[model samples]
Target chain A: MQHKPIHIIIVDDHPMVIEGLKTLLSDDKRVLIKNQFMNGTDTLTYLEHNSADIVLLDVNLPDINGVEMVPKILNIRANIGVIGLSTYSEPSIINQMIKKGVKGYLLKNVTGEELVNAITQVHQGDFYFGSEVQKILADSVTQESNDQPKLTRREKHILTLIAEGKTTNNIAEELFISPLTVETHRRNLMQKLEVPNAASLIKVAVEKHLI
Target chain B: MQHKPIHIIIVDDHPMVIEGLKTLLSDDKRVLIKNQFMNGTDTLTYLEHNSADIVLLDVNLPDINGVEMVPKILNIRANIGVIGLSTYSEPSIINQMIKKGVKGYLLKNVTGEELVNAITQVHQGDFYFGSEVQKILADSVTQESNDQPKLTRREKHILTLIAEGKTTNNIAEELFISPLTVETHRRNLMQKLEVPNAASLIKVAVEKHLI
Candidate 1:
């Protein structure tokens, strides 16, 4: 018995990219190109009547960008899986697409087999992350946000207490550290940041993603 | 006729936050608290059988950070709506969560009425963003990625042509610039970047996000 083919819509501005994808995906029996669009507006227009199992969306569309289009597509149909295809590796774009409910994240230069696998996995209700995509996700998770003090575990605990409006002496006594050490941390932070005061240093720490 | 109440889950380590959310949401007849988890791992466990229509997710989860857990929750159920609730306003984290398929992005200081509105909007398949969240999204779109060169539109067009192996004479002709001006730009770039050669300059420029 044969299974139903995976219907897909390709949305991109470049004719060469669409042509290339058609050529690459033509040989797969499980896949069928339902429609192709040159821009986000066209894709949305097509979605008014037609819905595909998966969508190959380019983030840098000429009209509406891929990140902006994710929500619009989901609004049309929540289950229509999107696989983002882009050349740039910016974390912001990647994160935006992911939050917009994209099931597969891949670079434009993805191997044919990987592309096929990603579509299949997403179709089967599993996420597909290319190696670089995974690295970007991990980096986002591990990297400290720009605001907040870059604190070690102990330092973080100290910061929490500080943010809670605790005094250095009280914090030091509570955390079993010397008041001199607390003063030392304060001094070190000021020196490293070249700030004049603790309040200003905290502001800097919050602004720089140092936390 | 009445609709089924929205099932909700609250994930945060802070007892105060849980109590506050409960207090805020309890009076609303449309919302029903399904479960509350202290961390990402517990939230993951609860999702095994119990499904929630909305989840109030905190970025600073005790076991796994919310940025990491956003994917995990989406992986569990692509349709479940997640609203990020955190004290942190770091663009990176907010952007990361948005990419991970959150339906609403709100700060921890959100009022009860606002939270209810967000949850209702998300449940009805609409995106929601607080004023600050909207500002963050707008700022993120404008904020240049550190990896890419921050070139003016003309410079980027020129650089793109150069990256495509265009000669200075060819680029000058295409961009309608004098050869002397091209040389001037080349020299200025070298001086500002402290690169020895054009090839090195292009490489460094691309690397530094300076187009």
Candidate 2:
């Protein structure tokens, strides 16, 4: 008895990427290309009626953010495996996608064999991460253990303004918040980031890519 | 009459990258894979005895820095085109490579066709930068035109220290420069960044990725 070929869908904004991936995976007999979509909306629309064994999803999409669309895709068909693909190796984005139920993460430069293996593994309920991705994830874990603070959206907004040397009044006015509230947020940021004052806070924040 | 096929060399540390690129370009009749190397030393050694029309050089190498190796490679064969390939799209790194005489820059995620086009274009003495790379270059130019101050190495060092909330004395001791000299550098940084005070200076520097 022969097993059915794994059907895979490619979703990326770059036509070149779709073409390249298709060409790379064409030689693999175990995999079959179902369709390619240039954005998240088209992929979602197609997936509403159709399904694939795996989805090669680009992290940055034109219409919908790929991470944001992961859950939606799973909602459509929870059994479909997703493997994040992108040029970026940012731990934050990778972790976000993993948290949202992606089965694997691969960089855009992935080898054809690696790509096929990741798709196959994810389809079989195994997790896969490119070597570079694994390194980034490892580094992020270490950084987190070292007390890297996770800032909320509002906190991050205020931090950007603060890094721009905006005064409390300036930030409060720009963000439409009370000066007292801004101060409280500022205090929280400093404490969370483990900085003594504004200067060190900005320095650490920039170093950590918080702004 | 038949023209010579464009001989190309691949110099990337990853075995997968070398194999993937070779596989992708195998079908292209216009190009021939002359050699492959895992590091800069082997590539330089191979180039010293032989020559190729193009070298798909990785920016980061285990033995020698790819950017630093560009001029050396050209020195070996001045007509040979060097294209910097990497996952990074940092404006500073790209500009440095371009300034050092690379004919093109490509992201590692480049499609087989784009890869072929880049090699061919560079071999023909034209320049090529991937779309993402082009955007970065354009953004850098715009930032420069917007009165963005270009800081020297010493100035940037001082600015980082300032952002970290270090005083003149601390910076002076750390850098082995006199307090007066550190103060001068600090003043110069503020003026160049077009900010009136230390806080604003740090803010702008962080915002611009100067730190």
Candidate 3:
């Protein structure tokens, strides 16, 4: 029985680097290199005719940027995942890629094994961050986490429901509580958050990953 | 004196599409087509040796989804802008692109004039969203904005400083207010957001974009 192959395309401008990647990745039968490109334009063109499981793209392209191609590529095929391969460990780039919905990011200096692992992780729909990238993300999280507020159980429950897009009346009904109680909880939340409306509440929930 | 031509590359699998794009863009003496490729691999490879000011990429490529390519291209060139060309308008894709720092997105069916405008805007470090895209983004903003919290001005200012990593003492010092007042503001913010700790407070702040 043949196993399903993970089709991949390596997009970079260097022939030597491409050849090295191919050689390093050659032994894995499950990973097949579908095609290669030297720039963003050609990759976009090829994508019109073909599809792959993953794309390993360098950020610095000769004619265009790799980061900018993400949306256009996804518009063509929503299912394909991209793993940003880069030489620099810039925080801005890492943050941008995460926001862009990249499944994984690997430094160009990573070992072949790590690269393969990153591709597989992304294919499985899990997020993967390089070691350096993780530190960058953690720094932000740490600074922010220090001051996090504690939630009362009732408030926590209310916030959860709110994040789930529940109406106040619905929450009251579900909790077998008075509408006034729900209102009080909401009021408390507003005072604590100093926000003015439900939209901001939801926004905060999403940002803090409270939901 | 003649202005320097903006270097460009077109990457798509369709020869006809490449030709059409070239013809349309070439009319401007300020634009130059450095090369064209049918795949991401070659485009990436060529970028190693050459450089361009912009890359006009199709959202769909036969090898990989275009959305996935944005960060990959950006990793290679920090300065080169990208204009994503797509046939559809997807909220997630657009949101993803924005996070990845794409300069602009253009539907494939857009007018040549619009395309020209998109490139120019992206090259100048401004953002361009096609008309339909603008509506989608506006809708998201509207939806998000509706959740605005009803915090007092003092609460809002305190929340802002808190989100920016200010301590109660620091905030009080900056505002020329008592630390007790800052704590009161913070406590009020927590009650409003319904989060119990400083960590959750910042989280809510980020979610609501209150900061």
Q: Highest TM-score: give the candidate number.
A: 2
The order by descending DockQ is: 2, 3, 1
Candidate that scores best on DockQ: 2
Over the stretch A1-211, how does candidate 3's per-residue lDDT look in tens digits? 9969899998876543565567667778879999998899899888988989998887777788766877767888888898887755665566666667678887755666777788788888887877867886788666543223556889878987775556779889999999889999988876665566654564555544345
Angstrom error at residue A101, model 2: 1.3
Off by over 4 Å in 3: A143-211, B1-211
Model 2, A1-211: lDDT tens digits are: 7779999999876555676687778888889999998889999999999989999998878789887999999999999999998875677778888889999999866888898889889988999998989998999898674334789999998888877768999888998889999999999999998876787887777666677
Q: In candidate 1, how many Å is residue A98 off? A: 0.9
Instruction: Indicate whether candidate 1 or candidate 3 has the larger lDDT.
Output: 1
Query: Model 1, B146-168: lDDT tens per residue?
Result: 22323456665655555454667
Model 2: per-residue Cα lDDT over B1-211, one tens digit each: 7668999998886555677678778889889999988798888889889989999998878789877999999999999999898865677778878889999998866888998899888878899988888998999888764334688988988887887778889989998879999989888887787776676787677655677
What lDDT is reached at residue B96 by model 1?
67
Q: Which residue pairs clash within candidate 2? A: none
**Cα shift from native, residue A159, model 3 (Å):** 42
